[model samples]
Target: MHSVVKLADAKRSPKWTDSQTESGSDRRFSQHASDLVLRQVAKAYRIDGKRLPVLEDINLTVEPGQFVTIVGASGCGKSTLLRLISGLERDFDGEILVSGRNVTGPSLNRGLIFQDHRLFPWLNVEDNVALAFESRRIDPADKRRIIQEHLKLVGLTGFEKAFPYQLSGGMAQRAAIARALVNEPEILLLDEPLGAVDALTRLYLQNELQRIWTQKGVTMIMVTHDIDEALFLGDRVVVLQSRPGRVRRIIDVDLPHPRDREDRQIARLKKEILADLAGEH
Candidate 1:
């Protein structure tokens, strides 16, 4: 099961500060404070006294609210890169800095959503999302409010009582997204979160993701095999080369959000990316 580490300082109050005007109708989640920077990051594993490299010399920077997507052929270590960023794997070369501080382990500041929903089969939507706050010191009322706000953010407002089995693939993914966002993470790392859904539902979720990203202003980095999805949602796309994954090229979408899928530039870039992927061995 996915979980967030508790806030380091137990005495510090919860960051979800709520204030009300006379009408008592305004509520907001705090914006993230840190941007992500990775410098010369490389990882390797040992197999029977032999070293196997996965990622090599990865250097990238994500602005505080920018959306960056990564694309590559299989075995290029896209998911491995996300694991390193999330601090799930610490044994690697180079440094990953967030706000000039090293990322040593998992914290609530970064949230990761896998391709699978990973929701507990027996837990309802509400309970699954609430799992993120299990180790938090937040008040019960505030936690409840945050859960509801994130559920509404992902269009799962009425399905709070539903279990994973009760939802369609798209709906389950939405619930996964909501659970990932419940902690108001500084950066949301998605490892092919939309890969399991059907075509039409994937398109709809793409729009929904953009809307949520616009509203929340959380920095996002996603890895996907879909070139169209990468172009439609990314401000920049980083392509990787296999055989000890390295940055092959970084293409700037250079287009605004809510981009049209039919844009000529997208079509042109798709051809280029396809050729690049096809040429890779």
Candidate 2:
């Protein structure tokens, strides 16, 4: 299920403030949608010689370039699921496919963003973003150009020279986003990328993300604790239950871009979803 919303009216919960933000965000939301398929994926962890299943027989699909959010109680394998798909951890059962290709290892085609902005403190914004392209033997000039373009795409143009230490939480996260996009990964895996930010900054970053997704058309799978965030950003929001995590429900947010905060249907849906998550009748 999927719903389009008015992009503007969507709730912005930024985690930071006081930074010159982007001139524009890249959103490649073509009318033509695509999807990623996860088939019967299961995971287990080894602890003290015991095998503990973290996830079991899970299956889900995210339309190509669609923004999908997974929310559930902690220890439900949200991050573990992301790690498997990102190819960080391959010790799992079931097939993880992106665009019909089985994900065996981390490839330049897939990008992963973590809760912490993994920017190198020594490197400036531009360099950090450009580092993503270092695997290939490219001319310095080309790499530099790619970095500049991606920084601008993530709205961090002038801060190219700013070190991670000099940036606010939101700014650093934006820089991380810029780096993630530098390689032009077909799918992005976010493990609570915005969880560490403040309220205001998180709001702004949310809007920035929408703009980017709408422009880039990259398939995104985000794990979030905030139900509202999931509702606002995902075409389909998947709620999971604990104890061998399973999908409790999948709801399609049927709104249009430039979403309205006060839209009656949106508010009602949010309330209903919240209630359902709360185990309310």
Candidate 3:
């Protein structure tokens, strides 16, 4: 995570707040649920025996089943922030609570998807997804059923026997998503999971992800560099400035589901975001 985020520069909240933010129109449900809170969280990377700050103090609240996107220039620590929330980094300074419990380490409750599919080349699609449930003590039949259902959930219903190499980039990533979700995580963390795919495939997966998230009711926080992607998929898009990345602005995408990227409103925000990123702020 040698990203551009420098922890020393992240602004922190003076006091940790416990009150949940009111359910915005973006939240699907009437009541609050699936909240992922980060309070003054900071992270630093160790490279060459030296400490480099990646993310400074960060505070955020993500409502249940909400699709939140974080966008920044490369190295602005967007991915590092996700890692901290995912408990991939223990050396950071901060408090992260998911649904009211402190996150000590990785849990089956938090599903993480990275840029690389990270599938086992030796395993088939069904087996790769089933691996997520390995530590659990569920029955074999139950596991198989879960795997089958999730494959369908990710639109990979008929590709059970396909291996990672056998599938296209988009399909493999979808399988990877099935694996992350097979465990039924409460929160989904996506770190540019579609970054490596071709443009057409990336666009297709983006829409598929929105449908999946909406149908499943799992909280989603995606980190990406594509401003259009962010505006297209996020309920609220958070913009970060580079060099010790900090939350510059949070925009509410009030449009309804199945958004059209070509919509005039989205196009307007896209230009504004691009302008802000270009130092026209």
- What's the best-to-worst order under TM-score? 1, 3, 2
What is the C-alpha local distance difference test score of each model? 0.84, 0.78, 0.81
Work out the TM-score per prediction: 0.88, 0.85, 0.86
lDDT of 1 at 150: 91
Provide backbone clash counts, one per model.
0, 41, 9
Runs in model 1 deviating more than 4 A are 1-30
Query: Where does candidate 1 clash, by residue pair?
Result: none
Residue-wise C-alpha lDDT for candidate 3, range 149-212, written one tens digit per residue: 8899888999999889999999999999999887778789999998999999999999889777
Decide which is better by lDDT, 2 or 3: 3
* lDDT (Cα, tens digit) per residue for candidate 1, span 1-281: 01111111110222222222222221221346357899999999999999999999999987666689999988899999999999999999999998689999998989999999899999999999999998789999999899999999899889999989999999999889988898889899999999999999999999888777766667789999899999999988999889899998999887756789999999999999998889875
Q: What does the lDDT read for residue 30 in candidate 2?
A: 23
Choose 1 or 3, whichever is better by TM-score: 1
lDDT of 3 at 238: 91
Question: Could you list the CA RMSD of all candidates, in the order they appear?
Answer: 8.3, 8.2, 8.8
The superposed Cα distance between candidate 1 and the true structure at residue 186, in angstroms, equals 0.7
Sequence-dependent TM-score of model 3 = 0.86
Task: Give the CA lDDT, 0 to 100, for residue 82 in model 2.
Answer: 91
